[model samples]
Target: MILAIDTATKWTGLALYDGRTLLAETGWHSTNTHTVELAPSVDELLRRTGIQATDLAAVAVAIGPGSYTGLRIGLGFAKGLALANQTRLIGVPTLDIVAASQTYSEGQLVAIAEAGRSRVCAGLYQWRGKKGWQSQEPPIIDSWQNLLDSLDGPVIFAGEINPAAAKLIRAAGKSFQIANAMNSARRAGYLAEIGWQRLRRGWVDDPATLAPIYLRNPAETSA
Candidate 1:
């Protein structure tokens, strides 16, 4: 079995996969309640699916470039579970999970997710068989305008795009395409799918040293 968790932002997600099939999945936006919500959600999911932690052959988690607190909570929990169960662990970039969730079948894509304080996390990706979107670059944090100016032409913009950023992107004319709302929702089934593939191919990460892809200085987040 494969268990995947994504707490890359306000959206909290989990999914269970049984090697050949997705058994169950869940996702919701929390009100700064991930610390309280995540574990219960996982427990309920496993109870509903009758999956035990010891049954997890591997676990996949979305490591950040996202909320400082959210990233820490998710990775810390995932590592504890993996270590406890002696299961394989893999850390997928949050944006990579964003890209994976989309149905963009072709062409270049710019997957963006929210970064706190009037900015966004951005990455470059392209469609590929099985993997859906393959990373062209790791995710980075920048203002939406800077990201728009840097693009050469039309590209699919997906993820939880800021409304102001969405408007600015649309104002760029026909060159920028926004993904449908459903496509923009980040779901962890895709994360499980990606992780299962990696598990089969022997691509896994060491939980002892894995860290969130924090693109901004921690000092910037001090309140």
Candidate 2:
């Protein structure tokens, strides 16, 4: 069994997956409560699914270009769990989780997460047949206007998009398609699936050396 955890932003998600089956999954908009709520939520999922900590063969977590405290809380928890349980640890990028949640599309897909202070951490992506969406480049922190201005052709946008960003996309006209709320909301279920694939291929991270990806200095970040 593999456990997936995502607390990369205000949104937090968790899931229990075992290659062929997704036993349980849950996600919610957590208004700065990740530290307090994450552990209990994981416990509840395990209880409901009748899985013990030892049953987890691997632990997958979203290592982020996200909220400073949020990334630290999630990664710290995941690392501790992996160390104590002696399970493999996998670190999936936060934006990749967003991209993984999206279905295949013909052209470009932009995955984004709120970076606060009027900016977002976004990555450009392209669909790969069986592998799904793959990032074209490393994610960058930028304002919505600059991001939109950089896109020329028809593109699909996914991940956490606030009202103001939505407005800009709408005014930018028909070249863009904003993924619906359901598709855009990052889910740990997809994160688990991705991790399962990696685990099968013997891909895992060292709990001792793995670290969160921060696009901005933690001290300077507002989120």
Candidate 3:
């Protein structure tokens, strides 16, 4: 069984996957409450699912390109759990998890999420059956216009989309222009599935050194 955690944004998530099936899942907008709430949430989720911490054979965490503080809280707990339990550890890329949570679309498929400071983190993705999205490039942090200008084809943008981003895409006037949501927000259950697939391929990471995938320095922390 695998325990998965995702605190990549204000949306924090937790899930338990028993190899072939998802046993339990939960998520909420914690609004930066991760430090105080995550561990307790994990305990409650485990109790609801009738799972003991000792039952976890692996720990899967969404290492982020999103919220710095949230990522730290999540990964810190994941690493601690893995260390104490002696379970396998995996760090699924947060964007890949986001893309995996969505259905595929025609033309170029793009994944994006807010990157703070008015920047959007965008990445190119191709769906892999069972395994989910495989990113073609590292996510880039830029304005919506800059991201749109760099693209030259019909594209389906998934992940985070607000009215402002929708307006920016409409101004591009591409064939498949304007961002309207095609998928719900990302969930840790998808992260668990991807982590499981990676584990099958022998792709575990070292908990001692794993860090969040930060595409841009955090403005609040860096400043």
| lDDT for each residue of candidate 3 in 1-223, tens digit (9 for 90 to 100) | 8999988777788999987899998988786788989999999999998898888878999887777787888899999999998889999887887778666556667877667667777888876776556788888878888888888767877777778887777678785443344365777888888888888889999987898878766655310
Candidates in order: C-alpha RMSD to true structure: 1.8, 1.0, 2.3
* Candidate 2: tens digits of C-alpha lDDT, residues 81-119: 999999999999999999987887778999999898899
Clashes of 2: 0
The C-alpha TM-scores of every prediction are: 0.93, 0.97, 0.90
Between prediction 1 and prediction 2, which has the larger TM-score?
A: 2
Model 1 Cα lDDT, one tens digit per residue, 30-85: 88888899999999999999889999999999987788888889999999999999
The numbered model that scores best in TM-score is 2
* Residue 87 in model 1: lDDT: 94
Clashes (backbone N, CA, C under 3 Å), per candidate, total: 0, 0, 0
Candidate 2 lDDT for residue 35: 84
Task: Arrange candidates by lDDT, descending.
Answer: 2, 1, 3
Find the 10 residues in a row with the least total lDDT in model 2: 214-223
Those runs of model 3 whose alpha carbons end farther than 4 Å from true positions after fitting are 127-132, 177-182, 219-223
- Summing lDDT over every window of 10 consecutive residues in candidate 3, give the lowest-scoring window: 175-184
Model 2 deviation from native, Cα RMSD in Å? 1.0
